[model samples]
Every structure is written in C-alpha cells, then in structure tokens.
Target chain A: MNVLRAIYNFIFELGDTALLFLKALYWSFRPPYRWRELFKQMEKFGVSSVSVVFITSLFTGMVLALETYTGLKKFNAESVIGSIVAVSMFRELGPVLTALVVTGRAGSAMAAELGTMRVTEQIDAMYTMAVDPIHYLVVPRLITGVTMLPVLTVISDLLGVIGGYFVSIVLLKINSHTYIRQMLNHTDLHDLYSGLVKAAVFGLLISLICCYKGLSTKGGAEGVGRSTTQAVVISSVVVLVADYFLTAFMF
Target chain B: MVEETVIQVINLYKSFGKQQVLKGVSFSVKKGELFYIIGKSGEGKSVLLKHIVGLITPDKGKVLIEGMDIHQATGVDALKLRRKIGMVFQYGALFDSMTVYENIAFPLREHFSLSEKEIAEIVKEKLALVELEGIERKMPSELSGGMRKRVALARALALNPGILLYDEPTTGLDPLLTEEIDNLIKDTRDKTGVTSVVVSHDIWSVIKFADRVAYLANGRIEFIGTPEEMLETDNQMLKRFICARLEDKLMTSLFNACRSRGSCTS
Candidate 1:
C-alpha cells in the first residue's frame, strides 16, 4: 500500500512538473519577457560556476589518464591515453560531472531562494501584484539552465582535454606529438555535440525539478531546507538516470 | 448606510484535509468602509480575508468583488480584477533581496512602461504618505517591526489599489505602535477612499478604528455589528473574549472608559 501511494504521488507530481515546464516555455516568448532575469541567471549558473566545473573536469580527466596509464604502459600502448581521456571527457564525463557540480551549486540556490520566498508569501505577493510568479521567476531560470549548461560543458571539455594532455605528456613522459595526434585522430565533432545535447537536457531537468520543488514548498524554514536538499538530490539522480537513455539515443 | 458592496462572500467553505477552516462563512464589506474581521488566532480570519483578494479559492462558494465571481472568472479577466486589490501580509512579505525603494517600484516595473524618474517619484510619495520619509535604500531586515509594516502599507498603497486587505496588521507591535498603525489605517482610507478589510484580534484597534466588526469563531461568523454593538452583545464567545481582554491591567481602565462611553451593560 505504501509503495503504491509513493508511485501514485510520483506520477502525479511528474505530470504537474511537465505542465509547469510547458507553461514556462509558453510564457518565455510572450510580451513582458524577462530577458534581464534570464541573463542574470545565465551569469549565476554559467559564469559563476566555471571555477567548480573547471576543477572537477580537470581532476576527473587527470585521474582517468593516470588510471589508464598503468594498464596501457604494461601493454606498451601509453601513447593513446590522451585519446581515451579526451573522448571520455568530451562524450560523457564532462557534461555529467559539470551538471552534478551545478546541481549542488546553482540548482540548490534556486530552490532555497524560491522556497524562502514561498514560505514568506513573496510569491503570493507577486500574484496579487498582477505578476505571474512562474513567468517572472521560473521561466528565466529554466531558459538560463538550458542554454548555460551546454556552454559550461564546452568549457569543461576544453579544460578537461588540456588536463589530460598535461598528465599524458608532462607527467607520464609520453611523447607530446603522439598524445596530441592520437587525441585529434580519435575524437570527433559528433562526440562534442552529443555531450552538449545531454548537457542541455540535464539543465532543463535540474531547473524544472528545483523550481517545482521550491514552488510547491510548504511548512516554513524547515520546509525550505527540505526543498533545497531534495532539489539537489532529485536533480542529480534524474540527470544520471537520463544520461543512459540520452547516450543510447545518441548512438 | 447607503454604501454599495465592494466585496461579498456567500456560503464560503474551505478545509485542509480533515481540518475545516471556514464553514459556510458569509460576509460583505461596503464600499469605502473600514471593516474589521476579528477572531482568535488560527480560526481562519486570514483565510476569509484572502478570499476577498482572490488569493485562496473556497471549497464551495462565491467570492464577488464588484459582482465579478473570482473563482468562476476567466484567467485574464480575473487577473484584471485582481489588479485593483492590494494586500499587506501579516509579516509584510517584502522582497528580501530588493531595497525599500525597489520593492515599492516592483509592481510598477512589472506592469507599466514608466521611467526610472517616475518610479522614483511615486516611491518617494508613497514613503511620505506612510510617514516613512527617507530610508529608501535600506533593506527590510534593517527596519523595525512597525517600520516594516508601515513600509509594507506604503508598498500596498503604491498601486493606488481600490481595495486594501490587511492580515493581522497589529499582531506583534507594541501598544503605541499598534495605535499608530490603526490611525494610519484609518487615515489611509480617508486619504485614498480605498475600501479596507483588516483581519485582526487586537482589542484596541477594533475599538478605535472598526466601522463594522465581524466576529469569526469555530469556522463561522458568530457576530457582526458596529463596535458599540460588539461591546453590548451578549454572545458567549465574544463576551468571553471581551472579558479576557478587559482583564488586562493597562486596558481595564481604557475598557471601563470605553464601556461608560458606549452601551455596554455587561
């Protein structure tokens, strides 16, 4: 019975969330559009999160190259470490890791801010003032997330490949020509495009989930905390789960 | 006595799960009247007041503002009607991120093409109207409770709304500040000719400012009359509440004088 109730609630909330997403998209192109808010959110989730994305991508690529060095060295195939790391970073890890980092940073902040506004009746005040809170608040963030995530993923891919090159040539004593030649030969534009497509979709999922949880928040300060934590957790999980299907579709 | 009805609720009902908040509550506020809906805490005074502004839809009933059904009205039409109503929340509900001036200017920027100079002028005038001169750059956290409420009042009035709804306007203020707010409420109506519906349980504010008072108790209006009629009513719940309020040491003398001045025989 409890499992059935949980499934029912999940299905119901999923439908509501999809409806909110449609409303956000419809309102974004209407008059009195919030371009300023959208740009502000883009700066928040894109530029402000650059440092964290750079660090996470750099470390993940470096580690992937180092881990592959051992097996590749035994087989005398260490020169291809650059290809392995670059392809992995560009095709999969870059978009997913950048999204997870942003889920923790910008997504949680969106949820907490909107949740606090919900608890304090600021959202209600917006409605009473002839403003649609979803249009004014949610749509800008949603557009920002969808557009900015791919940009962040591209940055992550570039920095990640550079990190892998450093690990392969500078640290592991591989020939720089071999490393660069292998990376350029094996990785294609299609790989980068696939990752960016996944990034855009992840951005939409995170923004919608966070804003939906936030707008649905009740109780009080405690509720805001719960919503924030849930936004991060739910967005991160959904992004990972969706990555598989996105990858399969790309193939 | 010859006023038109600005807000009307008929057989309004609302419930949260099994907890019924408002049960068949019916009331009407006259145009340009200073109306007070008083009840103990958690008895749906705010819920009923929210109905007037179309914030909370009832489970079953009609809330008509200017004879336009709020729940039944279409989206654009309902939003158009809601533009004429302004609300001051219990906690003021000012946008914490914005400065006082920007908070006052938010609705203007949202719905109008006014210049920054025009917005600044209107914000300054509203601040002056609320007796909160200067301090436009300060955040809501920096203001005292009374000052926040006053700022909120200024923000609500910034729209020049036709009807203003206040929820628990005096819940946390000291008596002197409460008196000031009560006076401001009356003075605002006098200055603006806006119909005001104040949800409060404050004895002093009701005694001093209410042109008509409705007593909500146990999900229904137990009594409704002028302030003097309230003082003379023998309804057990209202009389008990009055007696408890009269037990206050500072207010006892005040209530005694008020009783002698009115038709209280209790």
Candidate 2:
C-alpha cells in the first residue's frame, strides 16, 4: 500500500509539474504582461549570480584540469589537456555545475519566497484579487529561467576555460600557446551551444519544480522549509540525471 | 434595498483524507447584509469562506453567487466571479516584497488600468477608509498586528468589491483592537453596502455586529437567526458553545439572567 501510494504521489507530482510548466509557458506571451517582474527576476537569477557562478566554474575547471593531467600524462598526451578541459567544460560541466550552484542560491530563494507566500496565504490574496498566480508569479520566473540560464552558462563556460588555462600553463607547465591552440582547435560552436541548450532546459526544470513546490506547500512555516529544501535537492538531482541524457542526445 | 440573496450555498460537503470538514452545510447571505458564521475552532468556517471564492470546491452541492455556480465555473468565469469578492485573511497575508502602498495598490494595479496617480489616490482613500494614514512607504513587517489587519482590509477594498470575506479578523488582536476591527467591519459594511461574511469564533463580535448569525456544528448550521435570538435560544450545543464566551460577561448586568441559571445555551 505504501508503495502504491508512493507511485501515485510521484505521478501526481509529475503531472502537476508539467501542467505548471505549460501554463507558465502559455502566460509568457499573454497580455497584461509583467515586464517589470520579468526583468526583476532576470537580474535576481542571472545577473546577481554571476560572481558565484564565476567562482564555482573557475574552480571546477581547475580541478578538472588537475585530475585529467596526471591521467593524460601517462600516455604522453598532456598537450591535449586544454582540449579535453575545454570540451568537457563547454559540453557538460559548465551548464550542469552552474545550475547546481543556482539551485542552491537563486532557485532555493525562489522556492522559499513562493513557499512563504503559499503558507502565509499571499498567493490566495492574489487569487482573491482575480489575478492568476500562475500568470503573475510563475510566468516572470519562467521567463527569467529560460533567458538567464544561457547567459549564466556562457559566463561559466568562459570562466571555466580561463581557469583551465591557468592550471594548464602556470601550474602544469603545459605552455600557454599550446594550451590556447589545442583548446581553440578542439572546441566547436556546437559544444558551447549544446551546453547552453542544456542550461535552458535545466533552467526551466528548476524554476518549474521550485514553483510547484512553492505553490503546493501546505503545512505553514515547516512546510515552507520542507519545500525550499525539496526544491534544491530535487532540482540538483534532475540536473545531474538530465545531464547524462542531454549529453548523449547533443553529441 | 438589501433584500436579494447574493450568495446561496446548498448541502455543501467536503472532506480531506479520512476527516470530513464540512458535511451538508447550507446557508445564504443577502446583499448588503452583515452575516456571521460562528462555530468552534476547526469547524471549517474558513473552508466555507474559501468555497465562495472558488478556492475550494465541495464534493457535493454548489455555491451560487449572483446565479453563477462558483464550483462549476470555468477558469475565466471563476476569475470573473471572484473579482466581485475580496477576502481579508486572518494574518493579513500582505505581500512581503512590496510596501504597504504597493500591497494595497497590487489588486488595483492588476485588475484596473488606472494611472499611477489615480492608483495612489485610491490607495490614499483606502488608507483613510481603514483609518491608517501615512504609513504606506513601510513594508508589511513594519506594521503591528492591528495595523496589518487594517492594511489587509484596505487592500481587500481596493477594487471596490461588492462582497467582503473576513476570516477570523480579530483572532490575534487584543480587546481594544478587536473592538476596533469589529467597528471597522461594521463601518465598512455600512459605508460600502457590500455583503459581508465573517467567519469567527468571537461571540462578542457576533453579538455586537451580526445582522444574522449561523451557528455551525458538526458541519451543519444548526441555528440561524439574529444574535439576540441566538442568545435567547435553548439549544444545548449552542448553549454549550456560548457558555464558554458568556463566562466573562456573566457578572455583567446584560448576562445576569443567563448567569443566574448557570446553564446559558446549554
């Protein structure tokens, strides 16, 4: 019976998430559009997060270069270190890692904010005013999610490559010219595009899941806490799991 | 002038999990009437209020507001009907991100195409109506409990809705504030002539302001009459309910008769 209940709950959540996502997408172009809110969210989720994304991506790149250098050196292929780092960062690490960081920072904030509203009946306040919470609350965040994820992923990609260069040349003595040439030669526009595509997908999932958790919150203060934690954990797992499929589909 | 029934709820039933919150509950509110639904805590009064706003749908029966079935209405239709009503939640539920001014202006801005100047004028008027003036720039966090409730009332009135729902408006307020809020409820009803439905356990407020009171018990309105009529009733369930509130007032001259008997409403 518990197993049956679990499956039922999972299916219910899946349907709920899909419906919310679709409604958000539909309202994105609807009239009485909230340009102010969309821009506010974009700044919050994308621009304000640049520093954290930059730091996380940079370190991730450096660590990747360090780990792969020792393995590549066994085959006398240390020169290819830059190529490998750049490709990995662009195609997978950049978008996925940036999304993970954002899941902690901005995504958690979104869930907490909306969850607080849900628990406190602010969402119902909007409903009483004849305003659809989906159009008013979710649409702006959806726009922010879809638009900002790519922008943040781009920043992460550039910072990650730069960090790779620092480790490859300054730390590993791989030579700056060789590092630059190998990275540029091996990496293509497709790699960057695929990562950004992944970022956009990841962004939509994060925003929708967070909003779902926020809107569905029931138990008051404790419920808000539960929702915020669930949003971060679920979105992080989703990003990782989707990364595998997105990587395979893209390449 | 307040003769027509604006809302009619019939045989309403609702359940959550294994617990049934509302069972066969039924009532009606006339236009411009100050109606109170009083019961013990956890009697689903708030849930009943939500039914009128399309926030909750009963498993059986229907709520008709101006002849439109709220539960059966489509999304657009439901929104259209909901626009005619405003609900002031217990804790005020003011949008935390916006200032008091913006919170009041939120419904106005969403539903109306007024200029900022026009919106500000309306906000100022609502602030004045609630007797809360010149605190618009502050956030909801800055306001006291009474002040927050007033702001919420102001926000609810922003759209000039024809019906206002109050969910335990005086729940956490002190005696003075409770009197103040009760008077505000009366004043707003008198001033706007909007149909008012209040869900509360505050017996004093019900006795003071309600034109008609419905005492809900076991998910049904077991008694429906004027506050005076309710106080004079011989129903055991209601007497027991009123006995709790009549405890403090028993020493007073007005409640002396019920007190001498030692079994008011019981």
Please state the error at residue A236 of candidate 2 in Å: 0.9
Report the lDDT tens digits of candidate 2 across residue range B181-215: 98899899999998999999987777677899999
Candidate 2 — which pairs collide? B239-B265, B239-B266
lDDT, candidate 1, residue A105?
90
lDDT, candidate 1, A181-242, per-residue tens? 98889989998999999999999999999999999999999999998999999999999999
Best by lDDT: 1
Candidate 1: tens digits of C-alpha lDDT, residues B144-168:
9999998998988888999999999
TM-score of each: 0.96, 0.95
Query: Which candidate leads the pack in DockQ?
Result: 2
TM-scores for chain A over all candidates? 0.98, 0.97
